[model samples]
Target chain A: MSAVGSLVAGSLAFMAPLAPAAIGGLATEYVGALNIALEGLILVGAFSYAAAGSIAGPIVGFAAALLSSAIVAAGADLFSRKAKADPFVVGLGVNMLAPAAASILSQAVFDTKGVAVVAGLQSAMALPGLRYSDVASFAVAAAIIAAIAATPFGTRSRAAGMSRDSLAMAGVDYGRVRGAAYFVSGLACGATGAALAASVGAWVPNMSAGRGWIALVAVYLGGKRLGGTVAAVAMFSLLLSAAAAAQAVVELPAELLLSIPYFTAALVVIVGARGSARRSARRRAP
Target chain B: MRPGFRTRFHIETIHDAGGTKAAVRLVAALASAATLAALAAAFLSSEPSSALRAFFLAPFGTEAAFLSTLELAAPLAVCALGVIVSFRAGHYSLGGEGQAYAGSFAAALAAPVLYEALGPASVPLSILIGASAGALVAAPSAIGKRLAGADVLLTSILVSQGVIFAVDWAIGGPFRDRSSNLVAMEALPRGALLPRLAPPSTLTAASIVALAACLAAAFYFDRTRSGAAHDLYGRNQRFAELQGFDVARLSWAPIIAAGVLHGAAGAMMALGARGTAIRGMSGGIGWSAIGAALVAGSRPQALPFAAVLFAWLDSGSRQASILSDLPPDAGQAIKAVVILAVSARPAIAALRRRR
Candidate 1:
């Protein structure tokens, strides 16, 4: 029972860090834009958190990450909306630019290709007697999921997603709503990056390692529902943790095991076309 | 109606259409010329006169350096040409990096065994083997798209990363060269080396083959019905479907063609490097190819010029580092600036026209 509980909690904790990106994916579709720059946004957020944590406290680091990501998200929005560039291409260019910039700065500062440990950030801890950090992260994720599901803003965002012109007819500024949602989503992602950095006590280039895509898969698997997204993320995260732990007992290369989550996500997306039906049903429901 | 009148009407219409086409062509040529001049002026104003001279001419200052630059640009041009095909068909193949690596892996594996068995005959066989390996690795994404309605952009990217990690693991375990500490496979046999075109300059017959391939691609695009169909599909998929074109088949052709070219590039790189497959042997050429494709606006003929420009920057950066205090990374920065400039040009022009 204890082992099961721990496993469930661990999965939830892992899913928590993924929520912001899942939310960003959901929000992008709503705003008539594809948030393909999520990977780059996450990288920038991670680097910002690390840099700020090394200079200031963990709280400041988190704030810095949020600010930087919001700036980047805003820039992405401006380029896509005002410039009339292809969103997919521009998003890819943004993705390429981030890693190159990060690598150049990282090389200049640390004289290394990857990132170094930030000094001032607080690592995730068990709070003296209990494993509070993991539990708290899970709880925070759950609360955010519930809030988005229940809130008027979330409904409005969903409405915008379904049909931007219809939302505009209802006197909602679709662009502003999208811009705001993307900003908030980026902040959440930044905080998640900060948490990951704090928990691990170091950063590496490509540290997220397609986790942003996993979040995207979770969104699709969950049919863009708050509860379903959480459930999907938790399920995959558990698989990831189990795969990691299995490295000890199995002679197979860990890389092969690490591929399981991605393969699983792809399989789910392919086989479970039912998610689209559920989404349509939700649209028709009260 | 008489047949003579109908034929006369048809000739007149053709003549008028041809005239309009010639006028449009003339305008486009002028626009391109003006843009090139503007770019040159911008460069001249920003740098010292001597620096400007070196920037454009340094790569050609010596026969050896000029040849080496072409050799480096050849594989990049091939990969970029592949990217052009994929992009022209409206598919985002971000998997070129992985595909290239896959080909390299196959070539590296085949090199030693074939060299030992067949001596000098192993070279061409190894190249063919490598190209096939890349195509095989890339085939699944297209299959996934057709079967599952999966997004090629996402699936191809994930598969690319998976292939890279898998290759890394294989190198670390089964193919690990125990004699070396650098985590690379064993070196290829001497007989497997590609024939050099010029001694000590890395120029090889592979570069000539790549150039011929580029020209063939250009001809195919300009003079084929299927090529026109591809253009139509890229411009408007629903319209193409309405016109009774098989969208799936059209999309698949360009993607597979891209994979083949990228695979060929990998084989060429392995052959040129004398069968050594280092991690990152493609040296971000896939990404550079994407950049080149974007700059060329998915035109096969435009790829060589864009690729040469990139190669110039790469070589000029090294030259600049030796002659001045600027770092080699400065070249990378300049390349980034060029990408930003080109991507922004259309938007800037559109805004101006609007005003």
Candidate 2:
């Protein structure tokens, strides 16, 4: 394959895990909440996949990851809703709780807080040019698109954010709609974690790194549109791929190289925000 | 339509309505945090009694431990003051971690030269340089928010995270002390270090600065006309505009001011007993400051106490880990619970209404 072709393939593999989490961020965004805990949720999913996959199989591991993440997401949402506290604060709490919880569980079960390796399964579903996770990620993105475009839940979710009074007048339970969005976000982040762990055949502490935050950035940088968000994710994944490739030739420190995606994301958001503001100013003038 | 950008949580300073209610809530939250810590120790440790005692009592067990805890609180108190400044201006600057790290790096890098040139005066001057570095880190977010209507929270986190990695690189790479075994910069000049207040304890002059800052902030926010304008601008921009306040300056100035405080806090950490800019030293401090600020209800006068409370939790956790088999992180989890509990005022009010 040409260098360009290989780069594209590399980006696909990288995007496989990240796209779901970014999409999950979009799900929460639609509900008028910024789920900052997405990063922690991804961590939880990675740990679950590694722990379960090593004991059972990849299939079981995937199921467990999804279930556990969804439950955690739902539980957090329920706490915020019931407590009437700021969802953002509760999300921060979850972010703090996740690593601590994971470390404790890891030490209790695996006797190590560093890494948990999956047994007998290393990219078990590799395709000709793509991994199983890559294909599954594509499928998940498509399903999410279809659900939002075709389902009543999507309309209600958007309504809960954009027109809460109208939704209430229509006799819909706004809280439930928002809760469902959190559940979806959890499932998506879970998939992201599963893909990340499966690719390495192990879960390292903080394996999610900053993918969760990057996904949050993609949500806004994509202009809050699903397709735009996916495109943003693709762009970031490409950056990651490029950064990885650059490491071989670039004399820069590895830490600085790793920060490329975050820097680019911030730059994109700033530029995009400026453009939007200019357009708005122009619209107001005439 | 794009949602309008806003701060994640509302700011309720000491002058706000329901001061008594806020105090009650804070006390309840602290008590709840203590209970949670005890429960966690009981569940996580083989020797539950020892763990509980260490977590609840060890911070005040010895004079050294008490002073060390206060020393830790000094920087945290300053950081919380930063949070209050930003939040009260309706800007959520989540970049405290990065700003603090940048400040420490700048102070550490400049300390030797400053000490040579200015002697003992380099201590305060180095802190000022640290503050400037922090402001520089926050400038992008401030500019973005003021010019483009960008969300401060998002921009701040992104910029901060990126800066954090960059600072990490500097500490571990080019600026790293080659002779030292640890990934850290060369130690700050001895003369530039904060003067220790107690022998064998990390307590220093930073505590006095933190207390003075809190008191000064409290006075400014409660008594000055400009402070009233600042608060008005934060709570309601339209009304402040009608009242002839400078909205533009208010929008950006508080954020920059926050950067300054965060920077000072970082510099203090470097100058305390550590006397060096170490890799990852700024970890958790930023978020904990936010928690402390929230616990104080954005009240500057309450910040010192809140900071001490968090410091105690941290100190006790360390003690528990040493004395018993309790996981050190359990204290952090308890702190999270405290944050959640403190912010649950609305729910508590609702329950009261129902009753």
Cα TM-score per model: 0.82, 0.95
Which predicted model would earn the best lDDT?
A: 2
Alpha-carbon shift of residue B126 in model 1 (angstroms): 2.2
TM-score of chain A of each: 0.85, 0.96
Binned by DockQ into CAPRI classes (incorrect, acceptable, medium, high), candidate 1 is incorrect
Q: What TM value does model 2 have?
A: 0.95
Model 1, range B84-162, lDDT digits (tens) per residue?
Answer: 7776666666788878888787888898789889998988888788778777766766675555545556556667767
The per-residue C-alpha lDDT of model 1 at residue A228 equals 68
**Candidate 2 segments exceeding 4 Å error:** A121-130, B3-18, B346-355
Encode model 2's per-residue lDDT on B10-59: one tens digit a residue: 53422232445546556766788888888888899999999989998889
DockQ (Cα-based) for each candidate: 0.16, 0.56
Model 2 DockQ class = medium
Off by over 4 Å in 1: A1-13, A107-113, A127-152, A273-286, B1-61, B314-337, B345-355
